[model samples]
Target: MNIRKMADSGNDFLAETDSPLGLGESGKPIPSSPRVLSILSSVFERSIQKNEKLLKKLKTKDNVTVFHGSRAPTMGIGQYIDRISKYTCCGTPCLVVAYIYIERYLQKMDAYLTSLNVHRLLITSIMVAAKFNDAGCHNNTFFARVGGVSTKEMNRMEIEFLSNLDFRLHVTADIFRAHCLQLQKEGFGENPINHRPSNKTRAKCLPQIAGYTCRAV
Candidate 1:
């Protein structure tokens, strides 16, 4: 068995330390530490529950179609839309803005892909947005890690999305300005160093903006 231990801000203790168990600890159960046991139990329980939920969801027709299509499919419109929405909602206003970009790009291409699949566009939008905002943070590995898709998968999706939208990236100027205005109105000063707007103020303002945006749309 391989044991790996990482110490807090210190050198990692990958090798096993001398056992404090009996001289001959053979066949005797070494009781687990309460904290360790609690953590392990919680992790196991969560994993089991997550797997169970996934299994149950996969049994459904829609989800089964998505999972199967994810592996191999030319294109299923409904499944594509579903995946887009699911992935996009996984982030914040920045993500929402990215979603808008995807939609506009698609619209400009004369691709009548339904607004229903606006979600999938979000994932690509986020990648584009992240790249636009900070190239350092927008890499294949970064997308793979954050998006929970393999680098190959992300690349494929990116190409497909771009092709569908005729390679025209249309990130709106309005969303960022709107968010900034809202933050300023709420007395959240922009960070001078990073130039990133405050998330706390944005969170507070999101509901109001969403309602207004929805009404206008």
Candidate 2:
């Protein structure tokens, strides 16, 4: 399907959650409503959990074989990262930074402007990340294909998602990248890829490194 058709489908699907039109009619913050907030929270939590699981699976010792078994021949995370890296001239580190940024942002928001569409949110986040880190990141069709949405739909979803976010696009995790680089220079090495760190260790170490970097910056 084309972008316009996909966008239309998204609009219809989102309408079931709540209309943005209701914002003006009710004169209340759209996301403040309990129902919408609940839905957004649920969606965000589930998406984060799934992302974490996927990351863990990918970082496992047997990841190469397992990833091949779990994904289509052409669409495994490794293949995806490899393709992106060739264009970006950066390794999976850039993608990890972007994912971390998206997750942190979602966690901070008390609610979404509309019911959060987790799938679209994830794809959009990845697109934004690619644009930030890759010099050659321009493929709406690829994003749509990977996201199982249409380019038009993805664009519309991005706009709506940003609107709900009040147009504030903060790439908070960029600082973390600098810190991670420094740590690696100081001998942290490429262990994050080769060795599976516990989620808690990953989470804790990232923030601490980011904090140090921020002070240095």
Determine which window of 10 residues in candidate 2 has minimal summed lDDT: 208-217
Q: Who wins the lDDT comparison?
A: 2
C-alpha TM-scores of all predictions: 0.35, 0.37
State the lDDT of candidate 1 residue by residue for 188-207, as single tens digits.
23222222222321111111
What's the lDDT for residue 130 in model 2? 56
**What stretches of model 2 exceed 4 Å from their correct place?**
1-90, 111-118, 164-174, 177-217
Clashing pairs in 2: 3-152
For each candidate in the order shown, give its overall lDDT on alpha carbons.
0.35, 0.37
Residue-wise lDDT of candidate 2 within 25-47, one digit each (tens)? 33321211222222333434554
Collision pairs in model 1 = 84-119, 84-120, 85-119, 85-120
Best by TM-score: 2
